[model samples]
Target: MNILTELAQIGNRLDPKGAISFPIYHSSTFAHPGFGESTGFDYSRTNNPTRQVLEDAIARLEEGTKGFAFSSGMGAITTILTLFSHGDHIIVTEDLYGGTYRILEEVFNRFGLQVSFADTSNLEAIEKEILPHTKAIFTETPTNPMMKIADLHGIARLCQKHGLLDIVDNTFLTPYLQKPLLCGADIVVHSGTKYLGGHNDIISGLVVVKGEKLATRFGRLQNSLGATLGPQDSWLMIRGLKTLALRMKAQEENALQIAQWLLNHPKVTEVYYPGLKNHPSHATQLNQAKGFGAMLSFRVKDSSLIPRILKSLEIISYAESLGGVESLITYPATQTHADIPLEVRARLGIDDCLLRLSVGIEAAEDLIRDLESALR
Candidate 1:
């Protein structure tokens, strides 16, 4: 069977009634079979049948040894950072998501953990920033907003040479388009709220570990931190995942059309989508992943046109989040990457004129007309 077929078949074994839809185990705790024995789940935080199903599915899809589901994407990121000690340092992609940057600079920095931002697209830049205390390389391929691609296999090899953990945020491309673990990452993380959730209905995060030791460590941290996803949300994630392969295919198709249209538009100054032949990392992306994914960013010729364009959009939504079933646009300078210092944002080219688009499962022609109307 195909992976799409396999995804849709998740949780069938758990449906004792043959209802097709998996039942949500809503109980907070499982009953014990005996005084000294338990039914595998003692508490929801430690383990829940519904959450476990979603976790297992993600692990299988990513080809990892184990999986973890968290309350939110940030929760998963925070928990993963706990694996490092106070003095341990990390090298991260300079153009990664704003939330990740905020967490590292605002939350973790006070705890004594250090971070160095480097252009991970440039292998030499990454090599130069590795400190003696550097414990890991955290990066986002086809990075948030900017759509900057990183050389996953190369970075993984470099990490191995220095004994550093290779951590990748696979939220943008997702496992359907790219599997980082298969390309040599040690751990893969996702904001299930976006693509994996598919509907913008639930906020969740996922972690998949490449080995048993890392799985065991993450499991312990998840249980101890009590940031696990609830039964209902877990069920939602499972449902959303069932149609992910279909959703991604449609969304990527829409994205490519929009990107090409934008490249020739009079108001557009630049287009950043890895699918484009002229993209800086187009060859590397083609070599590492199955597709360019449905995320793209472009810069308008004038910053003054932004307000009018945002207001004129009919089919597309001016929103903060991405990877849903509806086309959404975001102003990264104010909305997503605002947490970064102005100088840093400028350096990374996430300026006032840049707009990020998360294409949906809409007809490509309709989306193009919507953009045309907005630009007019």
Candidate 2:
């Protein structure tokens, strides 16, 4: 049977139990009848039917051969990056999510893995930085905070030519909006804490591999390294995925209206949203993503104005994390991107006044009004 059919069957089976809404396989271990012989599951970490179902759904949605669910987004990334050895090198976008930048610059460096942050938007710059030790190219298109758009197809082509793995963080634009695997990426990673979970209550990560070989490799690491998502969290993500398309549609609209509003505001110095016609990546984002995505950023006319604007918000919460039923506003320089050095953040245009918003499925008019009142 097809994956969709399987998902429907699972839903149908659980519907009668009334447990489908939130099925809890709270056990840490599964009982096995005999040595090396099982009732299909030997351990919770190695396998869980609920987690499997979610993984299957993600794999199908991303059009990947298989999927691995992890404890967190960083967990998924670490698993993939761990595949390379000490001397191996990785090239990543300079404007990546700050957590990702921290991991590459801090943890990976200590492990003897050489990494270089490059402007993936510029092919020539990426080429200039590539070394013989380079084994992978990592990127996030419509990148975190900055909304910088990288040419996924172009990078994938380069990876193919060099026989290097291309890993794209598809968190900002979920499978519903943009499937990087279809664009030739070898691995598609997600901070399922974002749109995939939609509710923000669950912390989960997913990795969808392009083919059976890569899938097997990731599976081995996932099982051996043991960062698999809990059964309960997996169920949460699965349920959330059902409403992703719907939520994203509303979020895209909300984000577009809000971005336009910010652009016209006198106190707003600049808006960084691919939906805007003047945005550098507007055309490219349009070509790849279904919508401009729910994430947007803007800088205030003065750095001192930020505290007032943040305090003035009635609807959007000043917080870390994003992608939920409720909107969130984050000061990236102090919150999400704090780990990156001040010099590096400034180079990437993430100034102190920059505010990143993750629009929710709330009424666009209400959200716009909230922003208007805040900026006033």
Candidate 3:
């Protein structure tokens, strides 16, 4: 059976298997069978059946052996970074999500860890930057607001050659669109607060590992940090994911339509969308992703025009976060990327005029009309 059909069946089974949604296993401690015995779940801090079910569902979607849900996106990211110790080094995409960039620069750097930010798009740059101390290569394709695509397969090959780990932030595309593990990545991570949750209500993160070794390490760190997702939030995320395929398809369609429309607008200087034929990663995206994705960004002719346009819009709320059932918009330079230093922002090309849109499952014509009015 096809994926949608399979998903429907799974939903049906879960609904009748005692409940439509996974119940919050509210007890903090699980009863042990006897002395030196276990119920496979001794405490909530370590594990819970509801969290396990959600993790299993995510793991199946990502096509990985195991999955872990975290308290938030940064929680997941921090845990992954904890895998590397002091004196170890990592190569990261220069254009990372500002929060991740901040954590690595401020917190991790103080702990004796070393890092280098490089433009991984150019394989030569990556080759020149690798050193003996490098322990991992961290990357994000369709990175943040700039939408710069990373070569996952190429980087994965390089990671293998250097005996380094490969980690990918798969939040923007979600498992419904891209599975980095299939493209040779060692691990995949997500801000379940975004697409996986679909609605704007909850916040969570997920990490999926391809092997038992990494899984073991990740599990230990999860317990150590106490960043595991609560049962109630995990259940909500699972419910949101039930319609993942449908939501992604509608959002993808709307995004491409809006992107194509913006490309012809006189006031728009550039549109960063992998769906566009002119996008640098169009070919690679087609090879690796099931769809072009729901996120896109464009730069207006004047930075000041952003406020005017935002105020003019009837729909598409000006928001900090993305990947919701309703359309959302943000000026990354001021909002999401504000924490990054001016020099880094300029180098990453996250200009003030750039507006990132998370296209929702809305009518395409209605969305275009809103944009047209805003631009005018």
Top model number, lDDT: 1
lDDT of 2 by residue, 87-204 (tens): 9998998988888988888898899999899988887888888888899999888888888888888898899988899999989888777888888999999999988899979888
Q: Candidates' TM-scores?
A: 0.99, 0.94, 0.97
Let me know the TM-score candidate 2 reaches against the reference structure. Answer: 0.94
Higher-ranked by TM-score: 2 or 3? 3
**Error in Å for residue 356 of model 3:** 0.6
Cα lDDT for residue 264, model 3?
A: 97
lDDT tens readout by residue for model 3, 1-376: 4666545444344433667555678878998899999979988879988888888877887788889999899999999999998999999988878899889989999998899998877778987889999999898887888787888889989999999999999999988788899999988999999999999999999999999888888889899999999988888887888888899999999999999999999999999999999998898888888877889999999998988999999988988799999999998888888888988888788988889999999899999999999999
Ranking by TM-score: 1, 3, 2
The deviation in Å at residue 279 for candidate 3 is: 0.6
Model 3 alpha-carbon miss at residue 137, Å: 0.6
Q: What is the lDDT of residue 203 in candidate 2?
A: 88
* Model 3 spans with C-alpha error above 4 angstroms: 9-17
Q: What is the C-alpha lDDT of each candidate?
A: 0.93, 0.86, 0.88
